[model samples]
Target: MADEVGTYEATVTVTDDEGRTDTDTLYVHVEARDLPEALLSGPGTAIAGESRIYTLFGNAGDALLSSALWTLNGEYQESEDLGGQSSVSLKEKITFEKPGEYRLNGTLADEAGFQAQDSMNITVWSPTAHLLVTLTDTNSPVNESEVLEVDATVENLGQAKSDQPVWLTREGNVVDVIPGMELRPGETADVTLEWQTDPGDAGTHDIGVHSLNDTDSGEAVVTPGGGGDVFFAVGYTSPPPSTVAPGETVQPTVEVTNTGTATGTQTVVMLDIHGTPVESTEMTLSPGESRKVTTFSWTPTVSDLGTGDLVVQSEDDEASAEVTVQGSTHFDVEFASVVPTNTSKITPPGPHDWINVTVNVTNTGDTPGKQDIRLTRTVWPPKPTLPREQKDEVQNVTLDPGESTEVELLWWSPRTSDLQSCDGETKCYLIYTQLGIHSEDDEEYKMPYDRGGGGGGGNPPCTGPNPPPDSWCGTPVTLFSASEIEAGDSVGVSVKIYNHYASTEWRGVNIKSHHVSSYGPGSYKNWQAKLEADDSAQPGQKIKVCVTMESWAGSHLRSNYDPKAKAPAARKGSFGCSTIPVVDGGDDGGGGGGR
Candidate 1:
């Protein structure tokens, strides 16, 4: 009873004499029963190297679930099993790796020992461009001036969409180009090209294709005497193997034959991508004679993992064969070095200062790989860290063995309050960087900028400015000397200035006024001066002004102080005016300017 579930009573009676001697009643319990069902739900398709989550739904109808187990790719996944529980339902998640078809199986057991199994197919695909080349008729004989057809078939084997053009070439020259076309996963497109044989094109020709990251080629033969006479033919004795692992040795043989009534010589060669001969041998054959020559045995390196052509050729005869070199995948990334060093040092870094840390990563393995990089700055003395963590990602990073790339992580200096604790310490901050590939770590670095704090007692106390004592200043002028002038002594002050305006000339320039701010009016008297512009006073021109003074009261002249100077009315733009600071022995410094 699908819809009814309850206890029911049935009565049975048996009478021997008098038709009503005895009666028996039986009570029965009727309930619904269901088998445990296992259902899998997830995306059916995924790309290679992409992670996808798949869930298994286990349900035990009208019964408490005892256990739920999951299997991926026929392998039992103990970790993906839901422990035995009295709950009616259970769920488990699984992740798939690589491309191809995978089976996800789930088994659900109920408390009654009833079990059910279900499975789903997950198709994992990797977006790869595969190209194939075919001649309409490889064995057909064609005379000079004949037209031949070639086809290039391209397929997308990945889960992503792709649109790539296919180029057709004849004997290393591009003869036709097909416009790019979009192809969904598992889609294929055929591009056909026609080429006419020239008078000199009297032998086998290579018709090939160049497509997205892949190449394929085929051969077409042209006989000198079409359909009437046999001619020279050159071809590989046997086609090269479709694939060979990297570093595996391979020896391919080529056959050169004189099918006509003459003897001929041909060269069998194995060339690299650059047309440089890697292996070659000579073959001479008589009429109707074919000879197979083994050029050389070579091992394909990591750089040789691709499609290449092997050609056997004579003056008017040639044959081409395609060989593919395959290599196993490897994942390896290492830190090469940090640009500008892993350590950066700056004097008294300001709040607005920023330092860029560049980490170099190289593909040290035979295959391409990707990695993550991070940079962190740790402030010392128990201060809050600045820019606690910065992360960068690199995806689909393909590089040949030994190739390298660089990624930059930036660190901005923290506020003064954050680093104030390190003022008296030798090193203020520590920089730690990590390249998240194989758990590699770069050397720890330190930033030692000036921090304000404790000073040795022996040093004199600073009493001049708010910036503190022994402070350094930058200016356009450099003071050489400064000394106090006695009451009876005469002192001379010479000032020099630079004309900074590069584009315009200043006319009627004058040394309008001059004064030493540290000295009061009573300290000097009878100030007379002569000023003159340089003869060629052009932009960036320098001028000199000399002043003589008689002291009325002793005064101090600071060697490194700014002196005031004025320009004539004719000058345009504010002159970069500065004071020459008094230096040792009362010598004054010179000033510079630019408009």
Candidate 2:
């Protein structure tokens, strides 16, 4: 089956059917044959005086008649009948137990009278004798006062036993000589060496073992001598500056220094602001070596304040130190302002009239803060007058140190007799500023607005003329329902947008109901509105811009006004409008119109 050039032959035999049989042979021609090459199965070279096994195989052309024969230096010794085959396998285990060169020959014979032969050269190696040693100990970074235990293991991997003396030494000083110890071939021994390490310097030291082997010697590192005669002081660096604001982290660095002549190991520990140990680590310092050992970092929570400390201690030696940490200051407020002084504007008859109030905020804290402030105006004594309901405005602001900013608060009253009649009477207007601390970033300081007595009897005395038509004004917009909506049901909404100013500055009006997706202005072309009235309005009911809104049950009405354009030169008055709740399908009609 091999591709290498080799000879092959076929053998044939003839036999008769008689009680006795006679055989005849046909000789088949064969090409030149190749001998089985000899190969050593073990290592190429063996140790001198050591025994080894060598296996050999012979390759021939035909398996029926091939036999293998082997010779050493041209002298035949073994022959194997390969069971009538062209290839044969042979084995020879020879011991060049001594160091020297060896030559071998192998040959194969085939039935076709073909013969093949091959030879090989081999070498034997000598054995080397030497000793191996290692050191073992549990104590590391030894302290000056600690007992240093040094142990060694010695092994002989040579032809002869080692009758050598092993000695432990430190800094060129002999400590102990292991006497009467002899290690035979493949033998091992353990030796213990104890020394009270008192090197006067605090740093690294050298200690080792020496083996005297007749005329040769070997050395190995045994002990790591640190912490000489000096003592190591364990302590942390100064604590990081404290009084830090919330969300800030501080890291304090610690160091260990050897003040004595000996080198030793030390343990460092760090404690958080609450006196709780947060970190611990081990460190080794050499003589005169000052190692910055540990670091402690702390991040303060929103409710945390004041001072803290970090403590470090040495485990090998009883020594400790403490460092102190400090904390930061914070402050915030809500400020409110009303535009068009209360004593300067007249009350309008409709809810389309609007008043502008500004809420100012500031951060007085040593650190910055954020805030969410809301502005709202509510009418006293609940009644459906004009756009009767509380109006809300919200703002979020961040303030820096001593910084302040203002947000505008808007309100619209529906055009109705009840609201107009109570303007300077039983119904008092309240500008309520709900100041909340959303975060530490707001710039306004809030004051109490609900006490009723602070800003002048809760009502402004009679003021100036009613606002002109050219100013910004609003109309009644309402969302009504038949009953409280339940889960999984849709309801309808109605919206109304009205113009109440004396002068006509607006081209048209637009109404949008957030709860209902569809909304727009009336489609009348160039229709002049003058002295208008919603004849459909009922007693105790106000005129409201209405529309049908469809929504899932439990939904509330959210509506807003969007002007078609800036107020025109003809209309210059500011008006207020209110959001009202009404019947689901009733016409919220009524109003006075002017053009």
Candidate 3:
């Protein structure tokens, strides 16, 4: 039984009848009992339009193999299925027109009535395909329910052409669609879409354009208050503390722009979930004017752990924004030591001195945390408001449950003015170090400290009061901060105005005119501080004034404002201005551009 499937010899003796007298030897042949084995051989992988060889390894055990069969995917194959010789070898050459997986099989049967079969898989690969989508110039503020025009560009970067359809969606809903139209390799095309939102579509909406394999998206929002030639568009909304902790209050604001020729009043409202009103603010805007209105601050409780809408409305127009209310765990951090080293200084205490402060922080809280360290130098006494301040911060400092780390922050010196003099021979600058603990999960926890005074330990010599005997003491005008904005946009400027009258206190003092670059000192429309109203300063006192500037000209600008000075001699002070670079953009025709 062990020696199977082969020819065997058998012997027989004719002495059975006589038992011993006559003995005859006879030989007999034994047939093989094993079946023929069929083995199929072919490449496991191939490219479309390429030819591959498939062979059948066949054998019959001690017997002739009379029939050999070939099949593919359960279908029978002819003798010359691949234009090859029909023999026991059964070799075939095949080319697949399409890319996919296929099975090749072969079966062999011997004359002894036994058969065997074998199979193998072959894979075909097609060319590569890549699709890309792009959105351009989506930075302009869009109003709700208004017609928005956008261009979606599609490009094929792969070797194959695409016949898929491209779909454009807004807020997850398909708004526009286009056929691929067979884009060749490295080909690109643009599809323009004109989309108009429903009147009730007043919130932020994301628009996306996508193909089967790629996608791109941009965001837009609509504003409220529009009817009969007057339209108020909500331009922007910023939700502060995008993520908030439980029982925490956050201030959020909504900005609206008037794109009409006349002035109008609009009402903006904010609401939490459950149809409860939060805050409402009324704003009057002139033609081409845009104003930001702040609603009542919102406090989110533990039950408000999800997302809610903060809606703003004006007349028939409406806009809505999403505010996320989240909960978090508490953590704490401590400041161990704060050491400051002066690396460089200007003789007159200019604004560019390099002062490095090294701070040692420890995670004293129960849970591990990351700390935020900030160093600030501000002037005291709001009367002589040196609006200027120098600040630096280390954003994130990591620590273990009981670990400690040291970090460094840099600050520059504050600018000095002639009207403001140091109380002593040295000028006084108040230093403060603040430690904040914030996590991905919760709001920030803060600890504050007044680190005492700086400016060479005592006080750096600062410009002091000079009595008016000769041409009113020269008042030093300093530009504190100015917002660098894009061309065709508006910015707020903070300037320190000093009182220079020796014997007289100026009343009804206001910023009369201002200039940006060589553009204007035009009439004032909207300002943060109204000096002519209830605000005033003494002879040695300085006040901070915030002036908003707008220009359509695309260039860097410097701000200079002239204060209403009673005495002609006090007006001789030269005003220092800071340069703000305006980004490039054509006029949007919002009508707020400087004339």
Off by over 4 Å in 2: 1-144, 147-228, 233-243, 273-276, 299-304, 308-440, 443-500, 512-595
Which candidate wins on TM-score?
Answer: 1
Sorted by TM-score (best first), the order is 1, 2, 3
Question: Which of the two, 1 or 3, has more lDDT?
Answer: 3
In order of appearance, the predictions have TM-scores of 0.29, 0.27, 0.19
Error of 3 at 252 (Å): 59
Q: Which is the winner by TM-score between candidate 2 and candidate 3?
A: 2
The sequence of per-residue lDDT tens digits that candidate 2 reaches over residues 182-230 is 7777778887865444444235556666553211123322243443354
Residue 106, model 1: lDDT of 73
Task: State the TM-score for model 3.
Answer: 0.19
List lDDT for all candidates, in order.
Answer: 0.48, 0.45, 0.50
lDDT of 3 by residue, 415-493 (tens): 4442142345333322222233333333332212121112222211125544222111112322323323333334343
What stretches of model 1 exceed 4 Å from their correct place? 1-32, 48-55, 59-595
Per-residue alpha-carbon lDDT of candidate 1 for residues 152-231, written as tens digits (9 for 90 to 100): 56666665676655555567654445546577777777667655444446777777666644566778887674332334
